[model samples]
Target: MTDWIASPLEWLQNYQLNLLFSAVVVVVYFIIRRIVLPKLEAYVERDNLNQQTFRSALFTFSLLSAVVALGILLLIWGINIRELLAVSTGIMALTGVALFATWSILSNVTAFFILLSHQSYRRGNYIRVIDVDNYIEGYISEINMFNTILITEDRETVVYPNNLLTARATIINPRDRKRPIGKIEDFRKTETSVDGGLNDKD
Candidate 1:
């Protein structure tokens, strides 16, 4: 037990620079946590996207950035900077590959919330999404991440990827379309309606 502690302690003493580097890393990480991340999150929240997408991307980026920062911290603390650099490069390469590998899954997840937010179609709304170059008409039963649950007239449930949902042409009932209209308050009550009702329509 003494040998274990002694070895690490001796290493720290010999490489005091490593310990100093670690301290600097900790300070930088907290700075980013306090400053950068919050600003990015605010920007993401204000943008017009599915809340989930904004939240997810912000979270993922924060996690990735923190991890990278930690690695840099490790190099500063005691690990060889050369080795850390190599490891970081390798990690970046792997990240690029992973993002591409999971493109469809990510895209589907993003589009799912987008579909729901836009009210492009809602539960019980009839929709047609072409699959395999064939149009499948069905009613949306449930919409979730990755897959959308659709039920046909025959009561068969078809699960389709949201990526496909965004890509393919979709038809929604015109009656189901609802757009937002902001309220305007009249400063003074000037005119009454033809039927003796309040004329709020400007």
Candidate 2:
């Protein structure tokens, strides 16, 4: 029993550098989580990102950090970094192919970055998507990584793919208008004025 315990301890002592590297990785991870993450969160908050968008961005950042940390740990364990990178590249290539096979998934991810960079729309802002006889008008409730949630006038929630929004023309109304332009009453009034002017011309 003592030999079993001592054997593990000896192995650990033999790889003291690896042990120290592991400790350093742990410390760095904690620093990122505790300090870096909070700063990023604050920045997102300051920029007025919604809760869902902030959480998605944070999660993506954490995942990337974990992947980098794993690569460092592997390097410290005497693995050839070149070989590891080659393997990672192969895996990424395969993943890229898979994502390409599902075009919407890839497009949405691309559109997400585009949306992040452009502040044309935000939560609570009304937007009208111009489509062929399918004009969608709603207030943005949430903007997630893959989709933008819209709350319609009738209180119905609609999920629109990010890519679709990015690909199309969207009219954003920063302030909720008391009478939306699409209202029947407004259209009738315009039509009546046109008719009255036409009769006067006669």
Candidate 3:
């Protein structure tokens, strides 16, 4: 009976630190989601942005956080960092040469998260992007994981890169399509202009 009781106590003493750390990681994850998610929603809602996109962002963030937490737990239970890096590298190597050419695609994916947080653009919102080469005036039709689909005033469809859209100065028609010409607000700067650039009427 003493041996049985001592065995369990010894096991607990050995694993108690791991148990405490694991609990901490779980609690922190919950705290972050609880505090951060609502703030994200509030920011998106304040701008009248898409809740769907914000949810997508939240899902992505949550998934990454979960992965990190899992890694921490594994480490607490004794997984080597070098071993983890080797596994990660092996997985990357399996992707082969095509991975080398995915810089633009990866950048756009990263930019999508950044763009979704902006106040100036939304799905179905009429706006004009003042790109480096020229300007695109259109109604935002679809925003995907890679690109933003724009339907121009001339009935043309434009597949604009999320990276460029975030980088450039965009004009949003605040009154929406009904008043598509007056009071253009810049994407980078929140200032509104009435008597100036891009005379978009259609």
Candidate 4:
């Protein structure tokens, strides 16, 4: 047991360097999480939580924790840089798996943010989008990071993926902000055709 300990004793003798590095890393981690993140959150968050800011903070914290852990592991195990690289590669692989698993959720969330940035529609704005074979027109009930909740003229709330709403044509009612003017041009065309037919008959 003593022999095993002494075998790498010469290379691992610098306890002071390891301790200093660890201390700095821990200090940085706390400062970012407790100080910086909260300040950022205060600015970004009004009534709704800022998912993008929160995710950014989470990623930063995760990266810092992983780096600190890796460094400490190297110092304790006396492993060289090559082993550290291998471990980091494995961590990246796991991250890739996580991203793939939650891709749809992430996509919808991202699309929601994009729509908000455009200032296209807000709650109570009437709008319509093509879904499957027909376009669903309704008033915007709530816009969140995941799905857009729409209340149709029939007084039904329908949920749609944010991506679909942002991608397709949505007609908003400029008159009555309470209800969406789903398929605006279609209604106008129909009315015009009917009026022309009546005029011809007269």
Give the Cα-based TM-score of candidate 1 against the true structure: 0.41
Winner on TM-score between 3 and 4 is: 3
lDDT of each: 0.63, 0.74, 0.70, 0.63
lDDT of 2 at 96: 68
List the lowest-lDDT window of 10 residues for candidate 2: 175-184
Candidate 1, clashing residue pairs?
Answer: 18-77
TM-score of 4: 0.43
Deviation of model 3 at 87, angstroms: 5.3
Better of 3 and 4 by lDDT: 3
Candidate 1 per-residue lDDT, tens place, 1-202, comes to: 9999999899888988867877777787788778865654454344333455546645655676688787777666567878777888898786666443435466665565456556556667777664443566677776665677778777778887777787777767534322121122232233334334534443
Which ten contiguous residues of candidate 1 have the minimum total lDDT? 178-187
Where does model 3 exceed 4 Å of error?
47-51, 85-102, 123-126, 169-202
How do the residues 1-202 of candidate 4 rate in per-residue lDDT, one tens digit apiece? 9988886785467575776776776676677567755654443353243466456545654665677665665654457778777986797676556433334455555565555545456556677576443567777776665678888777887988776777676666644433333434666788999999999999
Q: What would you estimate as the lDDT of candidate 4? A: 0.63
Q: Give the distance in Å from residue 66's predicted Cα in candidate 3 to where it truly belongs.
A: 0.9
> What are the per-model C-alpha RMSD values against the true structure?
13.8, 7.5, 9.2, 7.8
Report the C-alpha displacement of residue 55, candidate 1, in angstroms. Answer: 13
Error of 1 at 50 (Å): 16
